[model samples]
Target: MPGGTDSKSGRIGAITTGTREAGRLPVLFLHGVGSDKSVWMPQLAHFGGDRMAIAADYPGYGDSDFVEGATRADYARAMLGLLDRLEVDRVVVCGLSLGGIIALEMALFAPERIAGLVIANSFARHPEGEAIYDRSVAGARDMGMAALAKARAPMLLGKDPPEGLAEEVIEVMSAIPPEAYVLGAEAVWRADLTQHLHRIACPALVLCGSEDAVTPPQLSDELAAALPSARREDIAGAGHLSNAERAEAFNLSVDAFLSDLDEKP
Candidate 1:
């Protein structure tokens, strides 16, 4: 694991794996809200063997410093800055939940910087987003991060879910600062990339858990239909956090997509 931190770049931190290879675009991962770079541990282990894989923490989460009133675009800028620090000109960006939204923002911000995209358990535009965002913000503010985590963690998984994984997820969520969570919630609610999806010229893989209650399969289905070069896949026995709950299936799907890209002219 090529794990390191960069505090010099204003507290933006990441967990990077794999050695850079010429002719291979690095894979950059962005985690959902309440999660940090560690959320993509499975992805790093699976993809790091053949290509560079990097997972970054959103501002104010994990080791990153708080960015007051940060929006999804702010997060995208942070990623671009991080890439600049690493001297990476192009990357295959993959993001889940809020991370996925940010990934789309990145595509919108600079389509030239992306080689491909993997958006998991996310939506181009959330219809009931205002209510959801308001509820999440108010919940965290009233109940504290830990209490909110305990209540929401169960819903994020499938019927069977995974043993002990809920606790693990809750632990991560519990650590998020209240202010960061509020801003992130607001960002998610305000996101409206529906009309802009066609502008993304890069190939995209839209993935979701078969039983995702939060973002559901329809969201991914919508994304698949909209993005110019997008495909959809659903992970069985998983929920919103498909990569963590059903890592093997998630990795295989993404790896196959990457392989296909490698074979292209």
Candidate 2:
């Protein structure tokens, strides 16, 4: 819980329900800015381990409140705290969009706790066409999310967002506090894990929507190229939220990647 308790050791915010039976290390999920754990509701049935599958609401977003003023570092620390409370020693850290930035930071600071890594619809930098983060922050703060939401929905969705899904997409994003969105945007802007990409030593999977404009395929390619053991996978007919927009294909990519790692020498 990012915005839970000011003290990492203390509980905070609205706790999301359900937990896996004890088995292996957990997959501790971190969501992007302007998003909550519910965004990954689609993955619950698919990715959680026998022991764990956890998604944390960023300090200010979702059920987590921003009692600590909300910083990217705070989110990372809260994750470590959650793992401590769960009595889990390690995790497969997965993140998307701004969440990926947090995963990169987790890898950088606490790689010992990470057994694997998944970076989806994310990048080490906002390359040429990936201007969504910057634009959303600026517009949402100055003019409000209405314009940002309208302009971004198409960029984030596939050519055809399956029936009855477009409105839900807009709602998930529009709920962000303009100010918290601004803060997270600033963190993403300031975060540059490019130099440390080679240091990600775990089994890493870098995925993107084939048509993603927010993070772009090139972004994941660069990450794959940089991480010594990383593999790149692209889900066709999807955009920023590949896991949600192209659930089947996206899960297949991740499953295959993880399965391959299990087979390695």
Candidate 3:
């Protein structure tokens, strides 16, 4: 098991584990809008054994302070600021959903600082983004986080989720402040990174859960097709939250990607 050290710097908070290995870039895990750094426990434990692994909470999500009217670029800057504070030069970014958009923004802002990218269950430009933003904000405002989380948890998971998984997702989502949730939803659903995809000149692994109705596999396909150097892999029988729903498969794909990175000259 990986023991994490939780720390805060400026407006960013993160859970870090393991030690930096020479010639190997650190791995930074960014959570989706509905989750915090805690959602990455599976990944942190799996990857923290021999290399630096850090999972960050977006501003307003966990220990980090809220940023009112934060744009997608602003979120990207916040992550970069966290890296600067930690004195980490470059990293392999692994992100899901909202986290994936921020990763793209970071690459666009500072390509030299991004060693590679692992984008899962995300989109360069969502087709139903506006409607999603409207529905989500309305749900958060009306039903409240707890109720909304309870209602959506089942949809976010596969037909047969692991025991306690739905409860975990509901718990995590329920804790998010309504104001913060709205901000994150806006930042995620209102942005478009389609034209900018070709600019991210790093190795990328695009992952999609076969049962992901949220972002859908078609979105991942488009992402891989647009990115300069990227490949697509589908996690069978998994849903939107594949990282948690099918952790073993998700970690295996990530492990293989990391191994390839290590083998590079």
Candidate 4:
């Protein structure tokens, strides 16, 4: 798929397919700190067959232009701005890790604009937030993104990942600019959205990989319990990047959730 830039909205870059159909909300896929829009190829392909499916590159990642000292709010606003440019009134957001946090922020920022949410391998409030941010930034600053990717890629996958999966992860993470990685890490790890979860009343599907040591299933449990209308689903034997590790299962869960949404009058 080709990438297009919305220069008016912080240069948000996105790859989209399919057409907007009546009564069907568009699905927007957001990538994690260590990934770009390409990680959602499987999802875009599957969902695009029936309705509009979009995967966006956050500012400072992939084809999007960089933003100096960007915060989570800034990222959320950029996405909303993109929606405005696209003339989309409402959407269903599917996000993982860093992307999940941004998705929550977007819902809180504009509850009326969001139809539903699919949050995977993420947390409302990380237990060791400061420590994780400090360590990640230090590693990125010291070893650079390439070396950091080589070291962290394995930790992001399950005990037994598919062939070349780790190498694919390393390749993707290595391509991220060190500065962008550091900036994204700070935004993701330092965020605390616990108090605001109640404000997002949209239906939500909270997913976590059974083998995810990064955010862990416990975090998803807490997130589901906190959200007003949310449920939890676990991707068996998968890790932090469950969508990539188990695309078929992830898509099935999301499809079922969207199907339920469509049934609502």
Return the top candidate by lDDT: 4
The RMSD of every model to the true structure, in order and in angstroms, is 1.9, 3.4, 2.4, 1.4
Global lDDT of each model?
A: 0.87, 0.72, 0.88, 0.90
Query: Which portions of model 1 miss their true places by more than 4 Å?
Result: 1-9, 263-265
lDDT score, candidate 3, position 123: 91
User: Model 4 reaches what TM-score against the true structure?
Assistant: 0.97
Residue 172 local lDDT, model 3: 92
- Candidate 1 similarity to native, TM-score: 0.95
Q: What is the lDDT of candidate 2?
A: 0.72
Using all chains and alpha carbons, the TM-scores for the candidates as numbered come to 0.95, 0.86, 0.95, 0.97
- Which candidate gets the maximum TM-score versus the true structure? 4
Give the local distance difference test score of model 3.
0.88
**Superposition error at 161 for model 4 (Å):** 1.6
Cα lDDT tens digits for candidate 4, 1-265: 5556564336988988888877778999999999999999889999999899999988899989888888888889888888887778899999999999999999999999999999999999999888989989988899988898998998899998878889989999999988888889988999999999999899999999999999989999999999999999999989999998999999999999999886345
Write the number of the candidate with greater lDDT, choosing between 2 and 3. Answer: 3
Please, what are the lDDT tens digits per residue for candidate 2 over residues 176-196?
777767777766766677898
lDDT of 1 by residue, 1-265 (tens): 4443443335687878788876677999999886778889889998888788999887888878788777788888888888887778889899999999999999899889998999999998887888988889888999999999999998898888668889899999999999988888877777889989989999999999999999989988998899999988899989999999999999999988888776344
